[model samples]
Target: MDVEKLTKALQWRGFTVERFATAAEAADWMDQAIDGVSVGFGGCLTAEQMGLYPRLSAHNRCFWHWQGDSRDDASRSDVYITSVNALAETGELINIDGTGNRVGATLWGPKEVYFVVGRNKVAPDFDAALWRARNVAAPKNAQRLKRKTPCAVRGDRCYDCKSPERICRGLVVLWEKPTAFEKMTVVLIDEDLGL
Candidate 1:
């Protein structure tokens, strides 16, 4: 992907884009940038892969559902951290969520939202990004969660199944930064991370 083009596109959409050579560099920078605050975490494999929970929790009052923290409490923190299912190089952010907890917080919750994205999550264009989110990311996540959906079972395209365990029930696309939010930063890591 063209990092320069992607950065310009995202910037035009009012997002702060920060590129990193590695996840470790980004994680260390974030740990130093954020401190002594209430930090919330969405259901993000990228953050988990970065070991953000343990690292940030040491200095910040952090909450994550993965660690038995209440979702409601985590959603109301001073800062929110999550990852998108697929990010368009043209500037669109796509996320397919089941319970809406992850996408919901991005829309309306914390004043500052951080999207920790890896190089693998970037797509060439908006349509490609949406397709990646639906087919690749969703199916992989479903398979990981052991959901009984066709996509998960076959490990292929989305069946758009009506299965009760369907995880791609809701979709969120951020074309630009919402006016209500104070800040939104996209941390682009060169390494592959998450599903």
Candidate 2:
């Protein structure tokens, strides 16, 4: 996957684009940006994979808990950085959230928003991206959350049933350009992050 192309696409959609070759570069950039910035983190596997939790904590800045966890603080954090399960080449982001905290924050919360994504996160197009979200990200997340959805128990693709435990209801696709805040950056990496 040519991550550079995807990064460009994201930029074309009005997102500040930053490309990093290694995890150190990405974390370093984030560390500098965190100065005087209240930071919010989503329950993203990529953030964990990049060791962002300890990095942020070591910096002594406030952290917000998205899942009512011990570390979340909704009132603070100047910015929020999270990982999406998949993004489309057309510049749409897809993520499945259990408690809607991640999506809610993404919609409107932090002054600035950042999406850290890998090359594998890009789909062929918008339709493919949504399809990947259902068949790939949603089912996997359902299983992880131990939801009672059909796909969760089957341990496979989504059945798209009317199950009350459906975790795919709050699907959001950002097709338009994002408004610029202090900074809305998208960090594109070659390594896979989440899902």
Best by TM-score: 1
Q: Model 1, 44: alpha-carbon shift in Å?
A: 0.9
TM-score of each: 0.99, 0.87
Residues 41-156, candidate 1: write the lDDT tens digits: 99999999999999999999999999999999888999999999999999999999999888999999898999999999999999999999999999999999999999999998
Q: Show the lowest summed lDDT stretch of 10 residues, model 2.
A: 67-76
lDDT (Cα atoms) of all candidates against the true structure: 0.94, 0.75
Scored by lDDT, the top model is: 1
For model 1, give the 10-residue run with minimal summed lDDT. 70-79
